[model samples]
Target: MDNLSRRDFLKASGFIAAAFALWRCTPREVTASVQPAPTPAPTLATPLSADDATTLTRTLRRITFGPLPNEVARARAIGLEAFILEQLNPESIPEPDILAPFDFETLEMNAGELLRVDPPGRPIGELMGATLARAVFSPRQLYEKMVVFWSDHFNIYIRKGIERALKPVDDRLVIRPHALGRFHDLLSASAHSPAMLYYLDNASSTKEKPNENYARELLELHTLGVDGGYTHQDIVEVARALTGWSITRPRRFFGGGGEFVFRPRLHDTGPKTILGQSFPAGQGVEDGEQLLDLLSHHPSTARFISTKLVRRFVADEPPEDLVTRATQTFQETDGDIAEVMRTILTSDELRASLGGKLKRPFEYLVSALRQTQAEIEPNRALFRYLTMMGQPLFHWPTPDGYPDVAAAWMGTGSLLARWNFALALAFNTIPGVRVDWDVLAGEASAPEGALDTLSDRFLGAPLPEEARSLILDFLNTLDAGFVLPALGALLLASPYFQYH
Candidate 1:
């Protein structure tokens, strides 16, 4: 996973080969030649053999944010096992027109937008809107999800004004392009992204005034484990090595290229040691590149990153053996993400841990959108919902970003916010998203029937009879119109529905 070796691998194998080669092997079922047309949509209720359930769960969680009605049907038609393989190999999947609704060029805004007529109204809102729109409406669901995953990994704060606007571009360029590619390239790209540079203060970091914020988090959060055996001196050395890497001012530079520019004058010429390895001295930005290489290939990084992937898709506390296996794959494959994913997807650990991890706020938002067949017009609602859930888009306050642990999400206030969100989403109270109330209502009879249909629509199966009865009882005292959305919301917020 060293930079030189990873780049060499890319050069030797081509980008496609680099991506696939880095992926650890997955034991996938042979794809049936007769793939089904994309219609009638897939669902969990579709009779799956016991063997298919494990594959189906992985496909639903990883292939896209969550499976919409049509997507679910397509999975059933193609066979769940084949669908998982296709998602893992996204390059083979033709680029789908998911961003059609988003005007990526004009929609972009940074601090410059603040100087406009309405200074108080920031274009950051619009930037977030475009992002959410793409996530919910775009056909390239897997890419969108990976973008989200990497965003959290290299979390930046959008509240930083103009600089925050660059994250979308960074996502498209730095993160998305190599999401499933080699982990080393991805690490280097994130390090050099204008968004990361500015957000972490690398833009202002100088030899005399080294900013350790990005450096510390880069090790603690981005690459090596929080418990990685690095010291304060190591962090300071890493920061010193990164001094002089700044972004071109949008207004001052080459027509807003807004890219990272290395200033040798601002860089530290003094030799430094990071992770116990000393650079001979006199290297400038290349020193930082070398540092990233060292960190990317570190044994701590492999285990740390692998455990995170497991947490995202498998279980809260993934098995030690699985993590070891994934870490081994990461090392052997030179940080190939697809290869690491192949290892996890094909393992007994993940298969046994399926349905154990609670879906995060962003995951919940995407899943709700998928289940209800909601149409995204502006995409502001998705961003708004994410904010309401305390996970605003590109707005993590610290360089360390949002937490992955369940404790960060639980509590009375957080639970209340989630309940309110669930209700609003189902009732169509949120702006820019539409749901078919009539179609939902027509599926069932009494309030219980309505509840049952809602369970199927949002939860992927019929409601538990007791849960159905409880919802029906709640509905008896309310209007039917109110009943359906309320029940729909309740199911979405259900404990059972929280985990994938």
Candidate 2:
């Protein structure tokens, strides 16, 4: 794609774009009364200037899944303002050649048939492994993070037939490219994709026996948040609007297929009203397109999407003021995702909310990988750990995607599972990944040094004096080999580690 200047880009678009630019012109003033939240201790924060350190930590934790060692160093070197500008606009960074390891052509291979076979070759399980490996190992950090975000936004369950086969292509084409683009365009693209149609049961939704499943989710889960103002009747009308949008069978049992086809014969040709807006309606694919456009601009869509972004990058309950600003950005930019992110990241409210949110399983896994500098090979072992950790790839049973709250992951079985994984990971018991416990401990005969070094290595700086003493006391009784795993387990299960 040719590079289009933001100035020119804004001018070509309509009034919505103008409103967004105007909103951006307004400056926010920080107040004295608001006490800034503590940063995620040690790892994500390094006690620099309080003001700059707070901004840097929130951006680091929010934008990428924790920072790579090089990235953190680079951010510190370049300073916070420059880092935020670069991340919010990574198109300026040339697309890195990191995807050469995977067979892109093969990923595009017969997407429908693979889902039909029992024990699918690259079920969501395998895909999740690939995703984690790439995100951790690839230099293309921005693309990977956007893919993760888009995947959650337009979630699809791989358990559905044919969808398991189709997800690889869905990731590469339907989601990734549009991850940072206009929401209207992305919504339209997803609505037409076979993976989405089949996954959500829209492929089977027909005129005579119209199914409301995909339609309801498209509005409720994918676009407008549940609380976004819309009635059940809106979902029905949207479903009717989406009638006849389906894909054709692949030629020769899943070798290759034609473009998605709109079978007007199967379409519900009736007048429909959605979100208080009426469509005279027809028997064509325009119904789906119109609905996507409408939802893309709805006030509820802006608030829903912005709030979700806040939850993901900030705290579970992000400040209403931050959400309001981000939502305003969304509405103004006509849902330009990068701009919405910029609004959130640059805000004082976001900087104030760091360390208050719990890390979801994926973030926890990635952050641990970065912290330990673990090497991933064979990849399935890492995949298995994610499953055991309760956040398997693409395998969410419902299309709503994985839950982000701490309650979902802090259960007894989950915590125990995390402890076992942490032990294995630190001790190099998990296949294809190894951590150097000896080096991690070095020549420290005393538990204090070992615990302190491990704390600094994993958590960024040394632990607090009390935490250090507690870990050393716990470690003093264990054998040398047992010392590393015991300390690792405690660190992984710490309330501190859980938040960031």
Candidate 3:
């Protein structure tokens, strides 16, 4: 069993090619007639059926990294509406001390303190580790998912100079605190972040020479969509309004740097117009604050943010009606993130979107770790696999962050990397990560029984009879000792596991 090669494993699971073909050609039922719940409650509007149960499981998969068995039972017990409410208010959920195993000093440090760490890159590494740890182990699953979403939405590359030191602060103060709060507050916090200012060269912007990097992204990526009505002059004026939003530079020892500071001397101090609104002259920091307020509450921002949320939770191409409704929720609630998410999550669109979205590399890795109940130490060894899969946390060089579409991730190299990871994890070859195969297998000792059990555990449903027959036939060829790991790896790498 220990000596089994990957080639042998693949050969045994020869039905993979056919499974993939069926997955591509088969049409899914992506239309449901369910109505949105007006509010979160403990009751359902209708009786739950097998299809409804499957839809709830798929919905859980969409919101969380992946649903553990206990989570699935809890959702079934309380119903999806109540579950959504509980997740929306994450303060109600008591989180396990998942970070106790990792001794990362940087999680608590301010940017000024982070700059002085002995090894320069240690802080970034610890940040990535803690992020993965939370995704895999946190009880507040939906809150963590929003953290990932907003992290991508307001991305700052960690490799940039001094940003390596500043981003941990941004992740702590700017992103996490307001991830589920109001959009205006989150936008304002990001506008004032030292990490963002440094990453986008806003710290060096001045009245004489304003940098448009942050301003351009603020319009195109952050708030307004690319097609959102804005001319080149709008970006220029926004940049001018944001001038003098800089980070402090320590002059003497312990003077303290890496804090956001407004410098009136560097500000434009003149009138500016943006998006058809004018700012009167002589305003200092209020200009940027006003700009954030305008952008966050803009109708375009509502539509743009709503589209991205639907794409994340519903489908690659978002449903138009859901987007419109979510936009209305955003505007009506004054950009309340939790209410907007409620609108999206409780909608029939999400239920109809079952198996419609593909899991990105990071989601795939985390889901695997979760489904297997893998004990992890959260270190570089695990991150190495993510790098191989092309989604190393905080490593995207561009401000747009990682791609969210299936086409961007369904390449040969990416799929191969996923297969290799499945093999490594099932064989217990990854350092600082281990899966107890016997416990995962439960009472199913025979190969046929083990296949059904593991399929339900991993995919939330049993495999089709033909596919099950093919896998069991292959398992018959393997030695008794090699059956469980091979079966587990085959299921993980299967096409069914590729989507939520």
- In order, the Cα lDDT scores of the candidates are 0.68, 0.68, 0.83
Alpha-carbon deviation at 34 in model 3, angstroms:
15
lDDT of 3 by residue, 1-500 (tens): 23446765564455345335434433443333322222211111221224767778767878898899989999999999999999999999988798898898888887777778879789999999999999999989999999999999999999988887789989999999998999999999999999999899999999999999999999999999899999999999999999999999722346257889999999998999999999999999999989998999999999999999887887777778999999999999999999999999999778765665678889999999999999988878788889988999998989998888776786777877888788778878788889999999999999988998888888777776655776787778777877887788778877667676
Candidate 3 Cα outliers beyond 4 Å, as residue runs: 1-50, 250-255
Name the candidate that leads on TM-score. 3
Q: What is the model-wide C-alpha lDDT for candidate 3?
A: 0.83
Can you list the residue pairs that collide in candidate 3? none
lDDT of candidate 1 over 1-500, digit per residue (tens): 11224433333223222212212121122122112212211112221123564356444755577676666777788876576667777777676566565555434443233234143334565567667766777666766777777888888777676654576567667877898889899999988888888888888999989999888889999998779899988988989999998887765222355678999999998889888898868898789888999999999999999988876666555677888999999999999998888888767765554444556787777777777777656655556667778777777787766776555776556655666666666666677767876786685767766766666555555544544555555557555546565566666766546655
* Model 3 TM-score, 2 decimals: 0.92
Which window of 10 residues has the lowest lDDT sum in candidate 3? 40-49
lDDT, candidate 1, equals 0.68
RMSD of each: 13.9, 13.1, 5.3
Clashing pairs in 1: 23-338, 23-339, 24-339, 41-73, 42-72, 42-73, 98-138, 110-162, 111-162
* Candidate 2 off by > 4 Å: 1-59, 94-105, 110-119, 123-125, 252-254, 281-283, 437-450, 480-486
Worst 10 residues of 2 by lDDT: 40-49
Query: Which is the winner by TM-score between candidate 2 and candidate 3?
Result: 3
lDDT of 2 by residue, 7-104 (tens): 42332232223222322332232222223233311122222124554446545755666676677778899986677778766676565554465433
